[model samples]
Target chain A: MSARAETLPATGLRLPRLGLPSLDALGAWTLALIWIAPLVFAAWAAFHSPRDALAFDITAPWTLDNFAAAWVAAPWLRYFFNTMMLVTTILAGQLVLCTLAGYAFARFAFPGREVLFYLVLLQLFILPEVLIVENYVIVSRLGLFDTILGIGAPYMASAFGIFLLRQAFKQVPKELEEAARVEGCGWLGVLWRVYIPAAKPVYLAYALVSVATHWNNFLWPLVVTNSTTTRPLTVGLSLFAAPESGVNIAVISAATLMSIAPLLVAFLIFQRQFLQAFLRAGIR
Target chain B: MSDTDSLDRRRMALYGWMLLAPALILLTTFAFLPTVTTVWQSLFSRGTARRPAEFIGAENYQYLFDDPVFWQVATNNLIYAGVTIPVSIVIALGMALWANGHLPGRGFIRAAYFTPTMLPMIAAANLWLFFYTPSIGLIDRIAGLFGIGATNWLGQPETALWAIIIVTIWKEAGFFMIFYLAALQTIPPDLREAAVIEGASRWTYTRRIVLPLLMPTTLFVMINAMINSVKLIDHLFILTKGGPNNASKLLLYWIWETAFSYFDRPTAAALTVMVLAVLGLVAVFQFRGLEKRIHYR
Candidate 1:
C-alpha cells in the first residue's frame, strides 16, 4: 500500500492499462495445449486397440479393448479395492485426527501447546519418503507389511492437514463456542454443536485434497507392498509397466490409464471444485 | 465430586490425547521411528548373503564418503534440483506474467496450463518416454522438422540426466506457476499503472516495481519447488530408475535400491537419514533468505 502511495497517481487514474487481451488469449490457448497434450495422448493411447497402435495412422479405430485387455492383464479389481480401502481409511483417520487436533489448537487452554503443535508440523518439512528405507524395517517389525492398514497408517495425520484445519478452526468465532457453553452445554457439546458444523467447508476441502493425494500416492505403497493383492494403483501400474522384457507401450499406457481412471473421471466431474481444492493445496 | 466437573475434566484429557493420538502415532511410526532406525541401521555394513553381517560403525557412511557412486548420486540430485527448480520457476513466472498481464480467455489458459499438475506421474507414465523417443516421438518430431538430429536422450550417459530434467521441469512449472499466479494477483494494479505512466521499460518496471514486491512469493515458491524436487520423484522408477550406469540415480532411488534390490536395509536407512539432513540444510537456506526479504509475513 505504501509503495503505491510513494509513486502517487497525483491526479490520474488507478486502473492498470490493458493490452491486446485477444493476443494473450491466443498465446494462452497454445500454452494450454502444450500442457494438456500428455493427457490427450494418454486418452488416445487408452482408447485405441493394440493392433492399431503400431500403425502411424491417426485414423485408427478406437476401442475399449485396451481397457478390456488392461483389465484382464492385472487384477485391477483388487488394486482398486486396496486403493479405495487405503484412501478411505487414511481420510477417515486424518479427519478425526486433524479436526480434533485443529480444534484443540484453536479452542483450548493448554501448556506447551504451540511448541507441541510446531513439533507436529515439523513432519510437514520432512516427508516419510525420505525415511522410507528405515520405515520399511519398522513396518516389517510391526508385521504390518502387505496389509492395507500398513500402507495407509503412515500418512493418516498429515501435518499439512492439521495446519489447514487449525487455521479453519481458528477462524470459527469463539463467541459461538462460548454461547453454547453458556446455554448449559458441556465442552464436548459445545465442540460438537459449534466447531464441527462451522468448519464443514474446511472439512470438505481437506477431504478432497486427502483423497486426491492418497489416490495418486506411489512411493510409500511401493516400498511397503510386495504383492498385487495388497498394492494400490500406482504400485500395480508400476509392476504392470515393468518391461525389462521389452515393454509394450500400448499395454503400459492401458495400465496407466486404468490406474488413474477413477481420479481422472472424478476430476472431470468436479473440475471446478477440484480447481479450488488444488488452489488451496498449493499453499501446502 | 460433582458429575459435571468430573466429566468435564475427563473429557478434556480424553480430547487432548485423542486429538494428539493419530498424528503422533503416524508421525512416530513413519517419520520419527524410521529416522531413528535409519541412523541406527547406517552404523552397520550389513552385507549380502555371501557374508554374515555385523556392527560396522559408520563404515557405510565411511564408504559413502569415499565411494564415487555417492558423489555421482549427489551430483545427479544437484543437477536434478538445479535444472528443475530454476527453470520451472522461470517458466512458471513467464506463464503467470503472460496469464496475468492481459489475457482474454485467461481462465481457459490458466486451466490449460494447470492440466499437467492434475496428471499423476503414473498417468503420464510413459508419456515422457514416448515424447523423448527419437525421430517419431513428439519432441524429436518437432525438432526434426527443423532438421535437428535425433538426440540420444535417455540412452547416453551425458544427456540422460538432462532428459529427465526436461520432463521434471515440464511437469512442475505449471504447478509452481499457480502459486506465483496467486501471488501476482495480490499485487495491486495501481502501482503498475503509475510505473507505466512514468514510461518505464518493461524490464525496468518488472525489476524495480514488480520484482521487489514479489520477493516473498518468489522465496516461498523456490523453497517449495526445491523440497518437492528433492523428496517426491517416484517418476524415476518409470523414466530412468537412476539409469545408464547410475547417471540419473537419485539419492532416494539409491536408498530404494539399497533396501529393496541389494537387501542392504541398514545402509538404506542411513542414506535416508542423510537425505533428511540434506533437505533440512536446504530448508535452512530458504528460511534464512525468507527472513531477510519478508520478515513481516
Candidate 2:
C-alpha cells in the first residue's frame, strides 16, 4: 500500500544513477505527443478550409464553415437525440434488471441459483454484437426494426452490470440491511434504502462505463438503424464521411469532431473522475 | 417446525426467481436464444420467395469450406487478431510503465494515452482516413519529404489491413494501459527498496521482479485484447469496408455483408457459428486453464 503511494523514484536503485532521467522523460513526452497527434491534427484540419487543411498550413485562417457544412450535410441533431435516448434507455433498463438479479444472486440461497448465475455469466462471452445476425431477425420480427428501443433493447440486460452490482452488493454489510429491516422496511424497502445507497460509488462507476460504451457503440446500431432518426452519432458519422459521400476531408474532420465532442468534452473536463470511475469499475 | 422451515425456503426461492426474471428474460431473448438459433439456422437452406426453406445439414458448412472469400476473410481476421493482440499489449505495458514512473506531466501523458480509447472508433477512423489518403493525405505528404512518391495505403490490399491494424493498436493500447497501471500500483514499495539495498540494476530488478509480477496482468490484458480483436470491426466500416477485393475483410464484417448486403442468411449463420465456436474456446481456455494461475490478490 505504501508502495502504491510512492511516486516511483526517478533515479534510485536503477542503472547506477546514470543521467538517463531526462532521456526517459523525453521518451515519455514524445510518446504522449505521438498519441495525441491525430486528435491535434483533426482539430487543426477541422478548423481550416479544405485547401489550407490539405496544405498543412499553420498560418491558415480558422473558420467554422467546415462545421457549418458538416451540420447541414446530415441530420446530426437527430442522431445525437437518438444516441441520448438509446444510452439512457439501456442504462435505466440495466440498472433495474441487473440490480434485482444481482441482489438475488448475492443474498438468496435458492435452488439452481449457482446454475442460473453461471448461465448469466455466459453472457459475458456471448456479446450481443456476436449475435447481430439473429438478433437483427429477432428485432425485425418483434417490429423493433429501425427504432431506438430496438437498438438498445438487446444490450439492456448487461452481464457485466449484473456481475459488478453483485460484487458491490455482496460487499455491503449485513448489519445495515438488518437495521433497515428493524425499522420495519420490507425486502424492497431495505434494498432501496441500504444496499443501493451503500453501492452508490459502484453505480456511478458503472453508469460512466455504460454511457461511454453505448455512446461509442456503432456496429449494432448501424445494423439496426436504417434512417437518420434512428442512427446514433457513430453510425451517422460513419455514413456521413463514407468514401462514396465524397465529402471533403475538412468537413469529415469537422463532423467527426462534432460526433465525438460531447463525450470527448466530458472526458477532458472530468479526466480524474472518469479515470477513477473506470478504475473502480474494475473491468479487466 | 420443519414444515415451516420448508415453506420459508420455498418463499425465498420464489423471491429469488422473481428478482432474476427480468434479466433472465432479456438474456434469453438476446444472447442465449440467438446463439441457439444461429446454430440451428445454419443447418437449413435460406428461405427464398420461390423456394421455401429446406433442411440442408452441413450444406452451408460445405459451401463455406469451399468458398475462397470465406477463407480469405478468416485468414485476415487471424492476422488482425495475431498482430493487434501482441502489439497492443506490448505498447500498453510500455505506456503503463511510463505513466507509473516519475515522468513529467504524468497525468497529461496518461490522459493523452487514454484519449483515443474514449473516442468512437468511427471518429478515429475518420481522422485516420485523411492521414492514410494517398497523394493528398498526410502520410504521402510526410513521405514526399524523403523524396518518396505517393503510396496508396487503404487503397492497396497489402497496406489496408495493416493500416487498420495500426489504428486498432493505437485505440486499444491506451485502454490496456490502465489495467497495467492498476496492477503496477499494487506492487509494494518495499520490494523496490529492498532491490536498492541489494544494489540490483534497474533493468535486472524490473525484469526479475516487476515483469514477473505483471504477468497476470499481461495475461488478463492479452485475453481482453484477443476478444477485442474479434469484436472491434467498427473502424473497418469507415476505413476500408473490407475492400480491395475483400483483402481486409474479417469474419464478422463478412458475415454482416453476406447476411444483410447479399441476403445470404444461411452462410452468415454458418459463419456466426464459427465465431461462437472460437469465442467459446477462448472462454474455456480462460476459465479453465488460466483462471487458476491468475493471482487475483
For each of the candidates, give the backbone clash count. Answer: 1, 0
lDDT for B146 in candidate 1 is 92
Alpha carbon lDDT of residue B237, candidate 2? Answer: 92
Please, what are the lDDT tens digits per residue for candidate 2 over residues B1-297?
999999989998999999999999999999999999999999999898999999999999999999898889999999999999999998998888888887668889999999999999999999898789899888899999999999899989999999999999999999999888888888898898878768788888889998999987887788788789889999899989998889898888888888889999988999999999998877787776434655553
List the candidate 1 regions with Cα displacement exceeding 4 Å. Answer: A1-23, A49-55, A245-247, B1-18, B47-53, B147-149, B196-204, B285-297
Candidate number of the best DockQ = 2
True contacts preserved, each candidate? 0.52, 0.74
The candidate scoring highest on TM-score is 2
Off by over 4 Å in 2: A1-21, B289-297
Give a tens-digit lDDT track for model 1, residues B1-297. 599987876677666776677678778888777667678778876766798767888888877889899999988988888878888898888788776654456666766676666666665657776676666566776787899988767777897788778777777787788777777777787776767678776578778877788777777788878887776577778877878899888888888888889887877777777888877787568546645655765
For residues A58-90, could you state the per-residue lDDT of candidate 2 as single tens digits? 998999999999999999999899899999999
Of the true interface contacts, the fraction found in model 2 is 0.74
Query: Docking quality tier of candidate 1?
Result: acceptable
Evaluated against the true structure, the overall lDDT of model 1 is: 0.75
Give the alpha carbon lDDT tens digit for every residue of A152-212 in model 1: 7778778888888787777888889889888999767877898889877777777887888
Candidate 1 has an interface RMSD (Å) of 4.6
